[model samples]
Target: MSILNSWWRALVALIFPPHCPVCDLPLGDEKGPICSPCLASAPLTSDWALRNDTPCDRLSVKGCEVRVVAMLKFHKAPQWRHLIHQFKYHSRWRLAREVGRLYGGKMAGSLFLSDVDWVIPMPLHPLRRMWRGYNQSEELARGIAEQTGLKVETKSVVRVHYTRSQVWRTREERFKNVQDAFRVAHPERLAGCHLLLVDDVLTTGSTMRTCIQAIVDAVPDCRISVAVLADAGGGS
Candidate 1:
């Protein structure tokens, strides 16, 4: 049975060679959707696991007591930006998941993240999700769960409104865009739980702040942490 499986895999690979989503290079037996070179050249943020306050400071200013961590520096890295584009626009869910797994493995032993009980991906509006086919954030959370053995809760929180894109919006505009955009679908499940909110990227952080506020409002006793694949504004 093992030999047959191997043979089938080999034949499948021959028929469709896996390619790196970022660089579009042939990925021969490489374990991820991104090439090694792209991964190595990606701009990683300062080690938040060691210092820990750099990323959280910005959230703290916003009245979020949550622990925040981002794995990559989003701006000024063409490779990383292209990778994000692939994951977000091209339906490369595997790429997002692989990146999440790598980051989650690093955070697995971190003092701040090791005790997280639930990994919750920032929810997308149902209509938007239907258009996009799948939520990139949820794929990322699943990857994090794969590494950390944390349970992933997808239906507990939902994006209630269809907001405009934040790409060209100012900081204040961004805040307004996502205000009251999220709601807790299952407050009981999240009550008193330690949650790690996962997102694809952090730009102005307005969206995350709104989501966090909704979660806190629904489950007052829930302690929340945050993790993103990239930080576009570099945080505080």
Candidate 2:
């Protein structure tokens, strides 16, 4: 059976060769979603697992203690932006997870998830999730969990209110847009657990603030840590 399955996979690969998501070139021998040549051009941040001030200071307002580690710097170059759009807007969830795996392996070697009790992907509103067909953040979290052996908590917190796009909004506008947008389910179940919130990108930190507010409101003692695949405005 195992040999037959291998042959079946070989046949499938022969029938449909994989191509790189970024350049659309035949992947050839590359094992990653993005071809190695394209992946090398990605703007990776200097610090992958180290506690960085960029994201930490962004959400550290409202007297909440937060730590952050960002993988990509989110360069505004066309290739980088297009790559994000491919996964985020083009339904490439596996690309998102594969990107997560890229950094999750490094995190496993560091103290990033050492003390985290839960890997909580920033929840998407049900309507948005349904529209997109999958939560990219959750896929990223799953990839990280696969590497770090952390538990992903999908149902504990949810986005109750669907939000308008925050891409063009000012920092203040973004905060107002997401106010009271998240709700914690059965807070007692996660009373003292340490939560490592995962997101594909870190923008103005408004959405995260409200989400953290919701979680802390429900479970006051739960520690909060933030991990983002890209930092849109990390050091601003």
Candidate 3:
């Protein structure tokens, strides 16, 4: 990190005080986005084991495993939502990298992220990317790449359309909302590589599924898995 970056980080920490993502309390020099208590309390689907099964098999697409190794569950934990909301809707770009670094560090020794060749973030619509100064997913990908030493290809996957928000939608509505929303921009790099798809949160799995499908269609031999900071809601 450069001096300018360090200064900027210090300024951010002073302003936000490094609150726990799950509790919204000061972290007290713990060197993370969340405190130890919140990290222990956060829900994780795969702890000691790595399940290759997709969260929603019905939405499974070819060429990607689609396993969601999420750190925290979304609902019933208002603080996680608030933290994610702050990064997404608010102009808290610092929080995205912090959250990503925390999650990526947790995944360092985990077998779930062991074989990834690339870390690819789910792209936002161009309009949304323009409206928002930064892409939360890209920030997470950058942080993961920094820790994992894996390449992050930001231009490989792109959102072809802008759909309505999935926050309050039902399962069916959510599936309809993200259909054909993403397309692969560079298939050559992904053709024979194992990629890990990253996102801020996993709710219905519709958006991730669509993005995975697009990549598989474009690159027939590409292997993929999914990871997120939070996983909210139940799925079959």
Q: In each prediction, how many residue pairs overlap at the backbone (N, C-alpha, C within less than 3 A)?
A: 0, 0, 0
Model 2 gets an lDDT of 0.81
Task: Estimate, for each residue in 53-95, the C-alpha lDDT of model 3 and write its tens digit.
Answer: 5444634675355556666756646666878888898787878
Per-residue accuracy of model 2 over 1-236 as CA lDDT, tens digit each: 99999999799879988777767789998877788877777677646455443437677646468888877765644456666677889988888888777778868857656688899999999999999999989989999988888889998998999998998899999999999999998787788888889997787788998899889888888888888877787563
Residue range 1-236, candidate 1, lDDT tens digits: 99999999789889989777667789987876777897787677646567364436545434348777778866656566777788899887777888888887877777777668889999999999999998899988998889878899998999999998999999899989898999899999988888889998877788888888888888888888888888777646
Which residue runs of candidate 3 sit more than 4 Å off their true CA positions? 1-21, 26-41, 44-59, 62-64, 75-78
C-alpha lDDT score of every prediction, in listed order:
0.81, 0.81, 0.77
Ranking by TM-score: 2, 1, 3
**Would you estimate the TM-scores of all the predictions?**
0.85, 0.86, 0.81
> So what's the TM-score on candidate 3?
0.81
Show the colliding residue pairs in model 1: none
Candidate 3 yields a Cα-based lDDT of 0.77
Cα deviation in Å at residue 197, candidate 2?
Answer: 0.5
